[model samples]
Structure formats: C-alpha cells, structure tokens
Target: MTLTAFLKDRLVYIMTFLFLAGFAILLFVLENYRYPGLIESGTMVYIAVFAVFLLIIWLAADYVRQRHFYRQLQEATERAGERDGAAIVNNGVTHEQKLVVALLQEQNAAFLNELNQYKRQQELRNHFVLQWVHYMKTPVSVIDMQMQEVLRELPLGEEAQREAAQSIQEEAERMTRGLEQMLHTARLDKFALDLHIRRRPLHEILRSAVNSHKRLCIKHSIFPRIDGEAWVESDEKWITFVLNQLIGNSIKYSKTKPGSKNLQFRIKEQNGGAVTLEVEDEGIGILPHDLPRIFDPFFTGENGRSSGESTGMGLYLAKEVCSRLGHSLTAESVPGKGAVFTLTFKPGGIHVME
Candidate 1:
C-alpha cells in the first residue's frame, strides 16, 4: 500500500459522517412545516405524504453516492497492485468525491515524484560503485595470484598464514561480486538503462550470452542447446542482460546428478513465428506461494536464499526490461524437479511495431 492509499482509507470514515450529516439536514428540511393556517387533519396528512416522498429520494441519493465512492476505492486498490512506477489515478474521482480525491491524489503524486527523484540519485551512486568495483578487481586478482604462490612455498608450520591469505582473497572476490550485483539491482530500481533497439536474431543474442557465461556453464556443467532463430526487434544490451539473468539463475539453481549437471538452455520457435527461450534446470524449483512475487523487484522467495550478498533484482529487472522492449516473460516450475523461463516475443494479443 502507498502513503496516499493509507491516508485515503482513513479518509473514508470522515466521508461517512459528511454523508450522514447531509441526510440529517435533508430530513429536517423535509419535516419542517411551511405554513400554520389549514385544518389539523389536513396538515397531518400533508406531512405524512411529504415524509414518504423525501425518504425515497434520500435513500436513492445515498445509495448512488456510496456506490461511486466504493468504485473509486476499488480503483485505488488496483493501481497500488501494479509493479511499474507510473502514476495511478483512481477512476472513482467524481464531482462528489473531488475534494477528498484531490487531497489524496496530491499527496500521492508528491510522494511518488520524490520517490522517483531519490531513485535517480541512487543510480548515480550505484554507477560510481560499479566503477570502483571494476577498478578494484585488477588489484584483487593480482593479490590472489601472488597469495597462491606464497602458499605453495610455505611450510607446514605456516598453515595459519596460508589460510589467512586465502580467506582474504576469497573475501575480496565476494565483495567484488556483491558490489556488482548491487549495482545491477540499483540500475533496475533507477530505470537507468539505454536501450538501443534494432531488429536482431533472437538466437544470436541467446548464444552470445550463453558463450560469455561459458566458463560458469563449464564449471557447473550446464549444457547449451539451441533450436531455431526467431527475429525480433529489441535492445541488444538490455536483451543480453535478460538472457544473463535467466540463464545465470538456471545455472545457479541446477542440481548436480550423480555424475552430471542437470542444467540446459534450449530455444525453440513455435508455429506462429514466436520464439521460446527455455532455461531448464533440475534444481530446487520455486514454491507455489513464491510464484506470484517472482517478478517483483527485490522479492526472492520464502527462504533467505535470494538475499544475503546477492541482490534479488535479476528477475525483477528482467521483467521490466522485457515489458519496455515488448516481450513477455513466463515461468513454470515443478518443485524439486526443475524450472523453465519462457520468453514470448509476441504476447497473446499484442502486435509488435515493425
């Protein structure tokens, strides 16, 4: 829920009182006698008739007002459920609900704008952090190699020195990876990627990302398999990011069979000219409860596996980038067996821009 949303829910109680007061005043006006001249019986009959007529009008007006307010509340709730950063306007804002909505909407817009600005500022900090991480890598690598040589020359009594040096090297590598992950995650939040869109072979991009991570694949023994080439217009860099995340996730989660790694990358073209990129891994698949939030930014799973040193922004950023570039990302997992991420270049009814 948003700040304005919480405020609006509380405001509903205040609106109830206003409506009730309006009804009370209307009843009072209807009951008041206009003149004091006619016979007593005639005056009594006139008052009864007027009360009955006014009661119907009061009930009808209250019903309409309540219904309209309810609809607006529904719209606000729906808007809060979306994942994007776009402004949400409740459809229930009407003449009757204007003043209340104006207050809530203004509060919402102010908060969202500030939130966006903060994200942009954070992006700059993340960019610097990424550069620092890259710069430090060279020194870290050199130290690690030098330490290995030192360890090889050390005697049995120098075990402590060797262990400490190895630990330092490992820690340095860990910190570097963590910083890189954080930078990527921050980029996801900041929405700060330049998308150079062009028509490209989907298979080409998939293969390139797979080959780049070939070392990891070899270490993990994840096999690569391609089916067909489906042409689609999209940003290559962003698309590469998507592939890295999807395939990386597969490799990370793959369970090693007794003698082989159970991870594979397969791409297939459907009959309707749609390409499906599947990264299937026989590992700890996602739970049913976690599926709904898999694409949410910073959301991992029920376990703490997604957090720790790793920033849980890979899938989140992938979803965002895919949406902006006009593609659909879908996932299906059989718990404990495997998980598959399917990319649909053309979603159900959305036509691509040629």
Candidate 2:
C-alpha cells in the first residue's frame, strides 16, 4: 500500500510508455531524413509529458482502491490473533483477492470450531475431576472408620482380628481402585505420548488382570475363567489398563447375585488377523436403554443408582482408550442374566514407530 510499492507494481505501465515514445522518435527521425523538421522535437516532448501525466493519474486511482483490501486484511488478522478467530475482510475488488479472502474465511471458521470443541472438553474434564474427588471420600471415610474400630477393640480375639483386617483390606482396595481410576483418567489425555505398541499375548494379559482382582473375586465368590488365547499387536500397559476396567465392572455387578457367579474371558481369532476378547459376567445386567450409552461419561443407569457405587467413568475411559489405540470396545446385556463387554482388535490397528 506504500507509494514505493504501488509504483513498483505498476512498472509495466512505465515500460509500455517508454516503448511508445521510442517508436514515435524513430518515426520522426525517418521523416526528418526525407523532410527536415517535418515532425517538431517540441511536439514529441509535449506528447511524452502528457502520457506520463495519464499514467500517474491511473496509478493513483488503482492505489487508492487496492489499499483498502490490504488495510482490512491487516485489521482482521490482528483481531484473529487477539480473539481466537475473526471474520475475513470482504473489501477485495478483484477475483484473485476475493478468492484469497474466501479461503481465509473458511480457515477462520474451522479455527473457531476447534476452539469451541476444546473449551467443551476442558469443561467436561473439570466436571469429572470434581465428581471423582467426591466419590473418593467414601472409601477414605470407610478406611478411617475401620482403623478406629481396630484401635478401639484392643486385645481382640483371633477371629475378630482377622475380620477387622479383612475389612480394612477391602476398604483399602476400594481406595486403591479409586486412586488408579483417577490416575488413569489423567493419563488418558496423554495416551499417545506414553504408549509403546508391540505384539502381546492375550492370555498373559488376561491372567495378570484376573490375578489383580483375585481378592475381590474371593470376597464376592466370583470365579474367573479364561477360555482362549491369541496374539494381538497393542500397547501392553494401556490394553492391560483397559482389561482392568472391564474386569472391575464385571466383578462389581456380579456381586449382587445370590450364589457364586462365573466371570468369563473368551478370546476369538477372526479372519485376516483380527482378534476379539469378550468379558462376560453373571451379574445383575444392564437395562436395554442404558446399554447403548454406558460408554458415555458419567452416565450411570438404573443399576448404578440402585447400587449407589458406580462413578460411570471406568467404561467411558475404556472405550476412549480403545478408540485412540485403533481398537473398538462394545457391550451387550440381558437385564436379568448378565452383560458382555467385547474388545475388538483389527489387523491394521497395529502401529509401529521406527
């Protein structure tokens, strides 16, 4: 928009004027060779000055019209930087300038969409943290009560001491689960940075996860069975965490039954190197309406309300982790019988970094 820049851009017009004047001078020279002073030198000079004046007037008009586009564009860019995004300038007179403006408008719209989505996610994360803290207090209070009871009953009988210890252990396990959930929830956002993908044996992962819940299984009298095995390419630590959530939910819901229940881990290998692991449990199953939305954050259904124990984050985190790892987690249930949670691993899901 500066005068120097405008003159440089219109340099072609000046070159055209020079070419026209040179042709006129050559014609005058040839005519004078035949008829002396037939074309006067002063007339040629007057014509050249007139051309220069016209060129100046044309360039001035163009500069005035085009500078508005540049000025508007500069203001919009500054506003965009200040406020997450802004509307693009629309003062362009030429097609090329209008095209550039339209492209910028599209980019600005996309940026605003992304910013709004990010804000919503942060809000959800903050709400979840508050809920997690409130839920954690239950286990803490129970542990405190158990410790005070043990201290009050000094010189207790052997059976009484064992019972007190078991109660304390159970509450401690609850606290441990809550703590792990919170930690895993925090890590979920940084999942890509913290994962190493490789081939892992399905049976080993199942056994390790089952063993971790052995105490809870014993207390609830639930028998865990591993049916089959396969090799899957996945992040061991993250996949294991996912398994833990599924197993925990199974044991929790199964404990509501009368007698000993069965928890099954069925592994099936599909065509084209795909594998599926199903965690099925004999529990008070999910209602039909709630099954579809179990993976949604903080969506505790009828069973959760009745039990008064579900934070509704375990399945949500499991589904999220599965999605990011290029696997899929799904569920199905018959309200009275039990529920089955499936983890599907496709052949192409394996990602290796070299």
Candidate 3:
C-alpha cells in the first residue's frame, strides 16, 4: 500500500543484497592489495550497473502487481457496500486475496438467504393469525346473537337470570373484542393494502363505537356521553377500531372509580379547520412514569397489570392506525384524576360528500 510498507515486505531480500555487496567489496579490497588495480576494474563497474538495473525492474513489477490488487480490493469493498456480492470478481491477484474475497461473497449470500427465510416464516405466521382470527369471529357472532335472543326471552321477574345472561354476554363481547384486536394487529403488517380512506360523519363513527361497547359500559356502571360533531376524513373501519379501543380502555380503568363514571366523546373544530375528537374518561389514570410509553406495543403499565385482562396492544394499534391515516393521536392524564385521548384530523383533508 505505502512505499515504506512495500520496502519493509522485501527487507530480507534487501539485507541479502547488502550482505553480498559487502562481501564483494571485501574481496575486491583483498584482491587490490595483491593486484593493485582490481578496485578500478571496468568489469566490477559493469556488474554493479547490471545488478541495479535488475533490482529496478523487479521493484517496478512488484509495485504494479500490488497496486492492481489494491485497486481490485477497493472496487470489491464498494460493491459489498451496495449489497451486490456478485460484482466481486477475481482479477489475477494472489491466491490468498482471491480466496478471502470468495469467502466474503459466500458469507454475504448466506446472510441474505437466511434473512429471506426469516421474512417468509414471519409472513406465514401472520397469515395464520389472520385466518384464525377470522374463523373465530363467526362463532363469536353466533354466540352473541343467541345471548341477545335469550336475554330478550327471559321473564321480567327473573332478576338473577337476567344478571347471569348479561355476565355471559359481557364475557363473550370481551372475547370478540380480543379477537378483533388480534386480527387488526396481524393486519397492521400490511396496513397499506387494507386501508380505504373516505369522508365520514364523526358523530356516526362515535355512535357505532359507543353502541358496540354499550353492554360493557352498563356492566361497569359507566355512562358514555357524546358532545359536538364534525366531518372527518379517515378510514372508517380503522378509526372505529381506534375508537372502540379508547372507549374500552375508559370503561375498564374508570369502572372502579367512586364518583360519576363518565366516558365522554367531544369533537371540536380548531381555528385551523382541523377537527379534534377527544375521548375523556374518569379512569384510574396512567402513572407519570408509564404515560410516555403508553403507545409502545405490549407495554402494560400499572393500570393494565392491576386489571388482569389487558393485552396492552389496544392503544398501540390505535396510535399506529392514526399515523397511517395521517392523523394525530395524543394523550393527557393525571395519576388519579382521569385520562383524555385526542385524535386530530387536518382541514381540507376530508372529502365532504354532498
């Protein structure tokens, strides 16, 4: 690489040359004592010139060979940076250098192949999760319908029977929500392909989500109140899922509170024409330490742990969905006061259908 390094590599040859030159000079000195003109001989001068010529040719050829190998190595390194191992072709370099390059290329290929295999396995697992969630949904729906019918048919005086039926219905609904959460979680991997954005009435979306959780709200003695309205552009299904998760969280955390258990949905239009939907809950609020990491997947905080039923994926999925839809989701909470989640939709983004 460097001139000094190249010369250092040929240090043995240099020492041998020096030793031979010294021996010749010593012999010449001894001969000159006997023949008096040996030191001035033209034959000795010619031999010195021929040795210098041969050394120059050998050094020049070695330099050229080493420079070529270095250049090839530089090119190969650049190609490797681009993840293109195929570009690393062996030029007539030393066998050791060529072997090293071949090994590097093989290692790169093996790594890439392993990465692709891992990706394929992950996809298959996700596919299976999606399929299983969908299949489970049918039975859940059937059970829910049957429970509703049974509840309606119960005698008016049968208080215990009604309560038992309601409990079963509530558990079934929880299972249904859990399954839906799993389905959404799986679909999150390919969210772009499944998303369909459109203009929708914010009130209608809120109402649907509220109705879905009405039974749970009643069971928890939590009253959901809706206030204000605005039109928003969003993917309805995904937004509804987000709303359900928020509402469910409110009901879950606020259920143990003594005061007015109010779960409120308030929509407001900002001065910038952005619409903000707030889900305010009088819940056992998030701890100060856990507030920042609430959106992190599978990170159940103190409240979740206490509940014994939190999967910790609800808020994470909601935040992700909002991000994909180009909306903003934020939270504010005091440890014991309450928690409020706000979803903001930008102005002019929602196509208003007449």
Candidate 4:
C-alpha cells in the first residue's frame, strides 16, 4: 500500500499519457513547419498541462480506494495477533479483497472444527482417567478389607489364609490389567514411535494372546483354541495388544453363558493373499444397535453395564491401532450368540507406522 508500489502498478497509464503528449507536440510542430503560425505552441502546452493535471487527480483517487482496503487488512492482522483465537477479517471494497476474505473465512472455519475435535478428545481422556481411578479403587478397597479381617482375627486359619491369598491375587491381576490398559492407551497417541512392522506369525501371536488370558478363560470355564496358521506384515507389540483386548472381551462375555464355552481363533487365508483372523466367542452377544458403534470410544452398551471391568476404551484403542498399522477391524454379532471380531491384514510390506 505504499505510494511507490502503487505508482509502479499504474506505470503503464503514466507511460501512455506521456506518449500521447509527445505525439500531440510532434503534430503541432509539423503544422508550424509546413505553415508559420498554423498551430500555436502555447495551446499545445496548455493541452498537455490539463492532461497531466487530470492524470494526477485519477492516480490519487485510485490510490486512496485501494489503500483503504489494505489499511483494513493491516489492522485486522494486528488485532488477530492480540486476540486469543482465530478471526480473519477483510473489508470487501475490491474483487481481490472479496476473494481473499472468502478464503480466510474458509480457513478459519476449518481451524475451529479441528480445535473443537481436539477439545472433545481431551475431555474424553480426562473423564476416562477419573473413571479408571475409580475402578482401581474397587480392587484396592477389597484387598484392604481382606487384610483388615485377617489382622483382627488372630491365628487366621490356613484355609482362610489360602482363600485370602487367592482373592488378593485375583484383585492384583485385575489391577495389573487396568494398569496395562491405561499405559497402552497413553502410548496409543505415539504409536509410530513404538511400531515395528515385520513378518509376524499370526498363529503364534494368537496363541500367545490366548495364553495371556488363560487365567481369565479358566475362571470363566472358557477354553480357547487357535486354528489354522498364516504369516502377516504387522507390528507385533501393537497387534498383540489388540488381540489381548479381543480375547479378554470373549472370556468376560462368555462367563454369563449357561455352560462352559469355547473361544475360537479361526485364521483364514482369503483370495488375493490377504489374511483374516476371526476371534469368535460363544458368549452373550452384542445387541444389533450396539454392534455398529462397538469400536467407538467410551461406548459401553448393554453388555458393558453388567460387566464390572468394562472401560469401553479397549475396543476403541484396538481399532485405532489396527487402522494406523494398515489393517481393518470389524465386528459381527447375533444377540443370543456371541460376537466375532475380525482383524484383516494384507500381505507384503503394506503396513505403516502412522
């Protein structure tokens, strides 16, 4: 908006005006040379002076119109810096300003949307932390109560002592699982740093995951069996964590069934060399409505209401991990029959650390 810059933009107009004045002077001189006093030099000078005066008035007027809009732009930018949030402003005095204003408005809207999304996510995390602390306190309360009883009753019976130890062990394991989940959830935000994608055996991973939940399965009378074998390109640590969540859910829901159930891991190699691992459980299944949003964060439906250990973050994190590593996680369930969570992985080095 400087005067020098504005004059440069109108340089062509100034040049055209000068060229016309020079052409008029040459024509007058040619008339006088052909016939003395045929055209007056003084009249040509007056004409040139009038044209110059008009050019000055026009240039000054144009500079004011443009400078008004630019001055507004500068003021808006300074105000934006002093403010707390995004607010881009422009006075649409020119076509260029109108277009620029529209673009800034679009960017401002997109920034607001992203900011709101982050706020919601942060709120959910804070709520989960509070809920997690409450869940952890339940086990701590039980352990403390059990110890108090033992201390009050001197010469505690060996049978009573054995039961106390068993209860304490189970509570301790529950606390450990909760702690692991919280740690894993915290690490999920920075999964790329911990990712190691390689050729991993699906069967071994399934078996290892089943073994980790053996105690819970045994307690629920659920026998887990892994079938078929296939190798896939994936990150072992994250994949294992996903399987653990799936298997844990299987056993937990199966406990409510009438009899002992079988937790099955059926690995099938589909056409086109892709591998699918299905964790099918014979437990009380998810409702049709809940199945659709099972992977949503903190979305515990009817089933979670009955389960004391349900944090609802488990499936959300599992699905997120699968997506980041270039895989897909899905669920299918019948209300009476148990649910099936299928994790599909492509062959080759198609996985990503993001």
Q: Could you say which candidate leads in TM-score?
A: 3
| Sort order, TM-score high to low | 3, 2, 4, 1
* Candidate 3, 1-354: lDDT as tens digits: 666777888889977886787688678778988988757767676767777778878887888887876666667766765666444555547788788767776787898899899999999999899899989999988988888999999989999988888888888888998998998888888987997887899999899889988877876788889999889888899999999899888988998887568888899989988999999998889998999999999999988999897888899999988877878799999888899999989765534322
Which residue pairs clash within candidate 3?
A: none
Compose the digit string of candidate 4's lDDT tens values, residues 1-354.
Answer: 678988998899899988988898888889899999887889878988998999999999988877877676667766775532234365667787788878877878887789799978986885687577667777776775676666566464677776666567666666766766786786676667777878889899888888877767777789888889999989888888899889878877888897789988899999988999999999999999898888999999888987776888989999998888888999999887898999998655344333
Tell me each candidate's TM-score.
0.54, 0.62, 0.76, 0.60
lDDT (10s digit) by residue, model 2, range 3-42: 8876887788779887987788778778877998787879
List candidate 1 stretches off by more than 4 Å. Answer: 1-181, 186-193, 255-258, 303-310, 347-354
Q: How accurate locally is residue 139 in candidate 3, as Cα lDDT from 0 to 100?
A: 91
lDDT accuracy of residue 76 in candidate 1: 64
Task: Work out candidate 3's RMSD over C-alphas.
Answer: 5.5
lDDT of 4: 0.81
Which of 2 and 3 is ahead in TM-score?
Answer: 3
Task: Report the C-alpha lDDT of model 1 over 17-86, residue by residue, as the tens digit.
Answer: 5566567555655555343342354655676566556755665565565565665566667676553312
Provide the lDDT at 40 for model 1. Answer: 56
Residue 158 Cα positional deviation in candidate 3, in Å, after optimal superposition: 1.4
